[model samples]
Target: MNPYQAPLKDMQFLLENVFDANTTWQNMPAMAEMVDMDTAVAILDEASKISRDLIQPINRNGDEQEVRHEGSKVITPDGFKEAYQQFSDGGWVGLCGEPDFGGMGMPKMLGVLVDEMNYSACNSFTLYSSLTAGAALCINAHATEELKEKYLPNLYSGQWSGAMDMTEPQAGSDLRNIRTKAEPQEDGSYLISGSKIFITGGDHDLTENVIHLVLAKLPNSNGISLFLVPKISVNDDGTLGEPNGVSVGSIEHKMGLKASATCVMNYDNAQGYLVGRVDRGLVCMFTMMNYERLAIGIQGLGSAQGAYQMAADYAKERVQGVAAGGSPTGAAADPIIVHGDVRRMLLTIKSITDAGRALSVFTGKQLDLAKHGEGDVQTKAAKYVGLLTPVSKAFLTDRGLDATIMAQQVFGGHGYIRETGIEQFVRDTRIAQIYEGTNGIQAIDFLGRKVTGDNLATLSQFVAEITAELNELQHVSAEDKSAISTRFDNLLSIASHINDNKLTQPALINASAVDFLDAFGYILYGYYSLLLADKAVGHDDANFTEQKSYVAKFYMEKVLPKADFHLAQVSRGDSAIMDMPAELF
Candidate 1:
């Protein structure tokens, strides 16, 4: 079997059973008649085939060939350009875009699932497409109608790609410090001039033109403004023209996802149009960022899934140590999966990845609700979506890196070899945690912004909802309910303690944010496993139910314990982090 199989059944279960995504779409008038189970399943299957057959073959090769920079131009690896053409031709770029702008108008939930599958097959190759989707989403929401009419169709169609240019030499995470400048010209256009670093898809030949959404400070503005700068200037007739002032100075050779073109973009008097109002650029940029943050989370999900596939396959085939029952009588050696430690590692990967998928789907559904649902339903759902975004981004990516590392460990010596592809998973997964606002920053956002700033109302409401779900499961048989309920309570108690204590130290809260993220992730996974178990009960498929039950039990017993450790540290407050002097470090 191919190593990158889509896990179609599992994805279907998540969309239909766990999230009831079909019903969610059905309720929304905008999406109601547009999508259904059959259509969704078909889309997923096609995306899976493209990912497995077209994209997967390029995964290792892309990493090996990387992106070569000669003078000013970048040479994408062999087959990359063709693969991108296939992707574009399939209209995959606009899978969830607006129909008015030539998109298929699918639900975001389905889009996320497709993205996860693509990322799993090959992260580097998938990024080019993912960023285009994100950039188009921003333009669709915030840009003027003229801009939308002119740019959206091409962007959605993948005839053109988009890149975000925010980070400068002086500004890494602090956007307030950006030095890029945009001067208004007599022709109502802006002359954007600055150097942007680490701009993914900055300059690539994959598409006809690269639309860059750059953040620059204007002379009259107090903060910053966003501008649309394309690689090649476009005429009023919608035809490509002379080269825009922007050029790729060079590309960064990264630790992983080598095929992804991380470039140093130089915008010297780049002909640009301002996106949104001048002072409100950051707000407009965040419209795209919220989506990117979630997409980055899915990146982690993909890495974890990919790593699990490699590890699971290795464990079943590699025979090393004897089984506990004395080599099964006449067997030469038992499969490594027979050992408890290996089982623990595999179970951890399964439990977290499964829950991560649920969380991603849940977030996607919330976005749908926020966008389409009515009145209070929309208001409440939108708040929940905002609250979960940081958690989903930070938590999923953090766990993804750990899960990938664990999967690598299962391969032991083989994992170190590039042939196994496990090391690449580790290297690739590591970036997810760092990017999309370093997981630490994400933690700070969760606690300082989401939890403390909001007086834990959002976090409390989330916990309340999960608690209510657990309460429902309590009515089940004692044996069936024990693991989930107990673990749920443990998770709830810690959250309550944090809320009740009213911890206010940002440093301490930030330090413990990652731990808090893990604790919440395990609890969330336990919730998902319980949901799966609840659905699997009395089903004729023993294999499905048995696997569900075993994984849930392992999660509650082995994974849930970490919540206590995290709470213990969180209880210590910020002194451990805040008390240390910067000079001392």
Candidate 2:
């Protein structure tokens, strides 16, 4: 089987033709100066080569070699340091960082494409740099200029890496329950004492130091405070000092992503500088959290694409018995690609993968518009970002996990073995749903913060947008029209019902939170598919347009109908869910 290939043609088609990302960037003042279609496409081509040649070579070896913890320092897999050196020398860690801090300052719309390529190359290897980019975002948004001056340049340039320290023993989803403590120092810094677990890239030899963004509570604060804690102390002149009382207790042995150093980090009087106000740490951290959520969602998509490539290649070569209804007198067996069941699996992966890519880019577009567009356009875009963020995160990762599993199954017993590497995709994709906030928490945030809080205003507006587009379709068949139109209606109506009864039906709403997110997720995918089909209907490449139409039809038939299953669960209320007693187990 050939190695995973970047879907460059499809990516270009979506960016230039379907999404018109070029136009979006052309109007944005920040990007208009530095980027255009030509520049962006060149960058994508370079990134694709990096993925295929440099990064992917280490993926399997990284998994097999994992990381070794020799006392205080963690040693990454062989070639990781060199690979990261290239990643750094290429200036990719800061692909979308602040330009003022020596970054390229690319738009997230384009950054998402780069991120997807890296994740496809090696999700674990990408984690080291991806976390740095995320932490730099938070510091850039909230840190004092002096702190930013000290850290941002190095973090962005790959001289230093970054980590987020929020997960403590007692605090997983609920940040308010965290026990990490921060005591004020006379020199305008804080001494942090905390034990954080599952810290990715918490410490490594890939860079000089790991700058940690830790969340801690002060002596008199009602809310948590954000702190910038470095593993090694940085002197006033921007030089390295001694270890700042931070050390790794141990790294967890996990099911997958073994190359990523998931550590139990102990900060004992670790010198940490405050970021933003003492009582607004969570607010500050959300800047980083939101960025990472979208990045992690892309991780799911990339991993799935990798698995699909492997399975598709395997099915063509590993011919066994003759396919059903094929010529019975054939001297050789037909490839499994000719079989219906295998085609169903392949189509399911392809349809969702395409739709997921569109969703990621669409959300990134909203983020850009929110940042740069004026007046009502900005407001609408920001609200759409909030409304769709959770759905994109949960749905993409949930489907990603499912897609990887299904792709592995296409290999039959070979999938279970390690040599084929399909099983590694399954193992790696599973963590995407768990980290970056579990998909369940994403749903709760969606139902509570985005949906119920807005009283369905944004949700209804989005549904209306979908319905209006459906109304404008030129030659949609009656069946597809009914399917698409009814889903749009169902989306708005169910949202309205939830809003109308959320107070009286809090229990029901809580129980149905995840289902509601899944239901809305299906609608969002359907809407994206519609947009793609509409744009491609009359394209010059008839074959490409025809393929787009077929994918949309497959989504409508095989995927969009899933909205019913989840929505029905939501409509059942809390009868079957909440009825169970506390001691039933």
Candidate 3:
């Protein structure tokens, strides 16, 4: 049997029951008319069918037949181009774009669910469009009116694709070391030169033109700048012209996600136009970076969901052990689902995945509010988004990789084989931890910038909110509340210690950042799962409500305890990481 199934019911429960996205939309003017329960459900249904029916079938094939490069042109797998067109034709590309630019302008909350579905179906296939969504966000936020008018419509329609060109050989994470140069010309455009590596969808035959948001250091500029470098130069009338001086050097052969093209692009005197302000390329790129970071987290969520479906299904059918209740009368042995350890593995995957999805969707709601809410509300939402962005990026992806690995173990030797498909999940999920800024960098951003850096007001507010909820739950029996409350206190104490010590040393902050990220993520997920339980209490669906309560208890007892362990490590500071000599490795 195919190991893929759309978790539509669970997704709907999270959206309508836990979050009440419908009510949230009713309160927001910008999204009120555009999204309702019916529309949201319809969108989800269409996305699921497209993902399961169309995308999942090609997943293994795409991986097997990886993108091939011959001479200057690169070729996608047989069905990719047509599938991309189908995705575009269905208007799926603009699920969350601005309506003014020929997009549906749906709320990001809904968009994120669609993203998770698509990723779960086929991460490599979904990335081609994901990059477009991200690049469009950057352009819409920072580009000029003409640039927006000219490009946003086609981009939103998916008639044209987008790529973000930031990395070079020497400048993967360090933007300052980039050697790509943009020389200003008399026609108000800059001539871009240098090579960019690991450019996803860099040069594909999927669309008419590929819009590259290139990052290069311009001469006589104070710092790096962003440029819009298209594959084919366009005239003022929006007609295609000669080829821009950009070419694909080659594509990389990687461990997984081979369906997606990872190209090394060479720009030799390519005509380009500055995107944002001079020397403000980093700032503009960050607009895309922030969104992409969260999207990567969703990628993790997708991988976990995909892996869990396979493992859970296998456990329910494969008979290898005796049941706790006793051996089945007619069967050779009971299914592995009856085994405590196997159940533990599956539950671990489910509990973490469910919480991860809630956290990600919550963040997506914050993104929507930040963009469309009122003055102070918008500012507060924006700050909250900033604070949670890194945690979601690092912790979710890290857990996603872990979860997939555990799920693979469920299949035993079958998982190791290419035919079983579990190994692909492991490979596809692993990259989420490394890309979009390695989880290490994400942790540093969470601790140093979000927590330690004078942004304490936002962090404090978040803690107070969670504390209030914990206090309310305290009325429950002491035994019931102990794990939950202790986890909350542990997280609060760590945040308080970080604030109190005021460690100005970057080294210390950098070293302990991953611990901080893990602590924050676990505590945050615990809080969200508690909220889910609260919402699930009154529902008439006994099975669903009971599942929610069980997951909440599991999170408090099993998952939340990790916060204390992380805090203990964080309190020890960065000496262990810093004191290690380079030669010791």
Candidate 4:
């Protein structure tokens, strides 16, 4: 396997050229004094080094060793503890946390880039910190001031790691069905009693403590609420106390992410403090869920980028069939790079991964603006955040799997063997689509709640923005511009059709949701491709500019047509999907 290299050039290009992140940060009051282009570049450089030099070496070995369940504790693979110590000491877990709570308070724009590199280096290792950062974000957002002061600092400092406990044996996506109980106690605490399955980082030896943000029902009510339950209780002076009844039943033997502990966590009347108002746990949890959703999307993007690098590198070295124009190297057999099919696979991965990265960064910018911008800007950014979060989680992972598989195909039989390390990319990325809410659930959320809930107002705003930006680009050709515009038009029309019939059609949204989201993803990628091409026009690196233009052209010609297929499926309504009887199967 080729060594993992963070795409620093592309990251810098997106930050400085396409997104103009410095200007955005300068305008936001909270971030204006905290970060800028120089700081972001420095952070990215350091992150690249950490990913390539520190975390990547353990990826394959971690997978092979896997996490072990020894009696009551979970032991991570060799090198995980040391690597995590280095990671935490660098203050990386708090890169985007609030400064008041010992966080660096960087913008999400910079944070997302850093996350991609770490994930590219090692998915299993990166997940431990990712959950920690996300749990801190949630506590900072909704937890009381006392709670924040007590826990946020430790979490941000990485002395304590965090986990999210939401799923149960019977309840996966539907939180309403959870049977976890939190009974009120006399001392202003609750007794949390339940077992949560598939809990990532639930109980790991990586940190001094594991703080869990748990979801449970209040006494005598079906209303769900969020709580902060610690593995080890904390005293008033912030000293560690006795065990808090939080125990690991066992670690799940999973398909991938073996090094990251997935536990069956049992809270035996675990002493807990409410993070938010009663019966509103789901709402508060969304704060963390949204963050994890975008992070998971980046997980997919990072995997795809890593896989592409390996494939592209291999294609150049592997000698295979002759080129259509004959061998340029005059060898017995030209490199596989000369073959059209190999090029097609490589280009497919390149086009999608590049666009996906730009989109992830774009989503990150919205998250920053939503948190730090003024009234209208904040409100608008929040709406866009809600609209794009699910798309980012679903579409990016969907394409990520596609890219990884294609990259593996480039290796032929060699890809299937574990020694090559390409199959690890495939196994690791597969979970991104499954966890952090499955892609199917994400699609339903996108089309059902986000788009149709507002009667298309927010989506219309997004469409108008894309259209205006496309028209303003000076480098794109009219033909290219028209092709994207037509898809945009078709998207709105299809959305309007769904809106007009959803109430009467009942099953329409559920049946058409996936296709609609897929269509939007394709159209959005097409838009970003052109935007990147336009921004790359006069870049100091002429080769980089040409590559961007080539990818954009390829996306428009070869990939954008997928929008039509999905749009057609959306036009068919729910009749075909809902026609079959359940018993017939």
For model 3, residues 82-111, the per-residue Cα lDDT tens digits are: 999999989888779889998898998888
Model 2 residue 263 lDDT score:
94
Q: Per-residue CA lDDT of candidate 1, range 489-540, in tens?
A: 5655655566555545334555667777666666677677777767666545
* Per-candidate TM-score against the hidden true structure: 0.96, 0.97, 0.96, 0.99
What is candidate 2's lDDT per residue for 286-402, written digit by digit as tens?
Answer: 878777899999999998888888888988887877878774558378777777788888888888888899889888888888877878989999999988888878898999888
The TM-score of candidate 1 is 0.96
Best TM-score among the predictions, by candidate number? 4
Per-residue lDDT, model 4, residue 287, is 94
TM-score, structure 4 vs. true: 0.99
Instruction: Provide the overall lDDT of each model, using Cα atoms, as 2-decimal numbers.
Output: 0.84, 0.88, 0.86, 0.93
Q: Which sequence of candidate numbers ranks them by TM-score, best first?
A: 4, 2, 3, 1
Runs of candidate 4 exceeding 4 Å displacement:
none
Flag regions of model 2 displaced more than 4 Å: 538-540
Clashes of 2: 0
The worst-scoring run of ten residues by lDDT in candidate 1 lies at: 474-483
Which candidate number has the best lDDT? Answer: 4
